[model samples]
Target chain A: MKDPLILVIEDEESIRGMLRMALEIAGFECIEADNIQSGHTMIANKRPDLVLLDWMLPGGNGIELLRRLKREDSTKELPVIMLTAKTTEDNMVQGLEVGADDYVTKPFAPRELIARIKALLRRSPGVLQDERMQVGKLILDGESKRIFLGQEILEMGPTEFNLLHFFISHPERAFTRGQLLDRVWGANVYVEERTVDVHIRRLRMALQSASLDYSSIIETVRGTGYRFSSRSVVPAAERFEASGMHSAHWQ
Target chain B: MKDPLILVIEDEESIRGMLRMALEIAGFECIEADNIQSGHTMIANKRPDLVLLDWMLPGGNGIELLRRLKREDSTKELPVIMLTAKTTEDNMVQGLEVGADDYVTKPFAPRELIARIKALLRRSPGVLQDERMQVGKLILDGESKRIFLGQEILEMGPTEFNLLHFFISHPERAFTRGQLLDRVWGANVYVEERTVDVHIRRLRMALQSASLDYSSIIETVRGTGYRFSSRSVVPAAERFEASGMHSAHWQ
Candidate 1:
């Protein structure tokens, strides 16, 4: 396969050089744009496989660029990661909410940045390998960002699909909202924790319409967190007579 | 260590005998209760490590038994798994919504039954060897069924406590509603999927009183499921500029 094309969008020459060098070393073909206009131009012309966007830029903001990318029919599905100097929680949330695929804070370890980049690329539908994930009757097609419950298609937003994809890939384990943001919303974002609840509500509502049995799939762990399990446990004493099973005795 | 005590509640003598024998082989001490009333009495007195409950009993239905157990302060913490012949999807939802820890269908293999029992026992707060699960400033005491946010005790219902406990124990993954019911609510229940949402709202409300950052801990994956994380990606992104650096590139 051809080397994955990576586009870097930033205003700092030094950082651009750094990213270009790192990405090239990591076996990706690198392209650089020094501002939003040039970035947009390059995106329109070059159509790189992935985009690395800096949150702050001259002429137009990084978020605006992201919105434009998402809004445009041609670029809506292109994966973009935000690079920002700000580490505040709200900014991270906003970036993710606006549809940035992932983000990285400034001064991050080169290895961590590379890993995030790779993960984002890997998660991009139909780009790399591992196209499908399943949990019980639920199936998520990463390539198409579609979900199937048995044979019927289940409709959901991008965020919900990503979240479900994450859960189906890893079952029987629980995750908190903060961790969810880190994994599903991406490592770099700033948003209110309550926002997770709103989205959860939305996701559930969508699933309910599909006639899929969503109850046994996502469990509330009470004051701790949430978990996914294939089967819920039966009370032991109740099990004996119902199943006509003999009880074990201990000395 | 002493063998874990398992209380078996069923009306059928032959089935009770089978469970007794099976549990003993699996290294558990068993106590038999032929009916719901007797089972409740034994639970109050014996405080067994786990309860194996039959859905249909002579005195009361298993659902009512679960409600009583969850309502009482002392027995509320006890983990209960339902045993039933019902294999329908609706039954599974109801069993979990009512607060059973897990469930096993009738005609289940002895090995499968034992495995489910062990998994539930391991997840029970006091029974398992792993006592505490910590993330950030939050601490979950599995033995006491308590949550401490930086030394302050956080009050929660049994369901919320279990949810939090599960999230802390298993981090960095997402869970769908169906999976949660199977793990947190147990199987063989017929409850509305909306019930999970109500419980989640209640759990969040309880956690809010403690000034704990519960919002960031549990995230909604929009169209898919819920997740728990230690960090809120959105909030963290706002602080990025403070790091004194920014990426420089365009696209």
Candidate 2:
């Protein structure tokens, strides 16, 4: 997918230029708004996917504009990151409380800012939101946020759910740990790559709990990460038929 | 840790009573304030870890109180999740724009509220805040938000940093995927258990990036999840000495 368009609302030409250069380098489309008046108009007219707002702009307090944007339904769900020179907890908390998804202090690293922007864009609704997708009997219902294996509900955490959902959506493609982390955990969020292994184990365990052997559909590429395979596997149910030994117990 | 105290600010007696029962059942201590005046005073005096705020109140709007709270440093960072009967997108947006952490509609499930509370509590800055901890040459400097391998800086994502930090904090103890999620990812956030593994791999990769042979510190428990070993291992630096090959390429 092409990078989402980012609206930059800042009074300072230098900072706005810096942001534009950084965002464009990250492959995102950018639109500039010099002050709150222009920012509001730009938002209403352009309807950018995400916004990078200045906390203090010429003519008005940047926060009031944020409140106005959030108070309206049309602009309410828009992901916004507040850029400010203020480092006080009062301002940071107020900005966040006022619905800013992220608050970055001025003179911030462009790399980190781009990373934060990407992360927020990914978290925005409808990006990862998808209707139910099925691989074998394992069903991921996105609307209700539930997973089902045939008649039984498969209990798993949100990370596992998203991971499974991502895998199932792109069935049969092998994803390395780095790609999975960026797609699943997000770029700004950090954790060990091995964490992927842990969540996968839990996913398989959930499948086991439902008394299903559909876990084999999520194949492990020997040297790399994992893949959700659409192809048929030697049915584990048939393989262990005589033992009647449940994989759930083993997990 | 003991369950954190939660203050429920609502005008309705029945809803407050329901909240009290649910919170008490979940082992959380509860306090209630029926009006904006009392709610403000209760927050100031009681200093609860989390607040369940009602949107509309008897004397004034509840969102005004939220704005006031967010506007102050003393009350700021005190997690507040809005409880509202109003299901309008405008109300939700305004409440959130005013800085309410999570907004829940009336007749909501108590279980979901508690989950959200736990998640928000875990996300609060101080809960996981700790001074730097060192395991060998690796240092997780909390204040600087940087990791150091000997004199070299280690680059990693926040999740990997936290996972490593958490592991280093409680070395040698095995923690299940559920425990890790609660402590590291926060409760409401979801992902697969195998995600833990993927993160671990990523963590090791980070260590490799620093040219460190410390990957052996994190060990996967046979039956459950993972553990960080504080004990000495036959240093791989010595084991593969003849090859003169760095582990970075292997990862």
lDDT tens digits, residue span A227-247, model 1 = 554434324444343233121
On residues B1-251, what C-alpha lDDT tens digit does candidate 2 reach at each position? 34578999998899999999999997898999999999999998988999999988988888889889977889767778899897877777566556666679988998788766765554443334536666656667664455667766676776888788788777768999888988888765677888988998888778753456677778888889898874544355543541233211111
By summed lDDT, the worst window of 10 consecutive residues in model 1 chain B runs over B242-251
**C-alpha local distance difference test of each model:** 0.70, 0.73
Per-residue error for A109 in candidate 2, Å, reads 28
RMSD of 1: 27.2
For all the models shown, what interface RMSD does each have? 21.3, 14.3
Give TM-scores for every candidate, taking all chains together and pairing residue i with residue i: 0.31, 0.38
Give the alpha carbon lDDT tens digit for every residue of B98-186 in model 1. Answer: 56656778867877777667654543432233366555556676533456676466767877777776765556678888877777776
Best by TM-score: 2
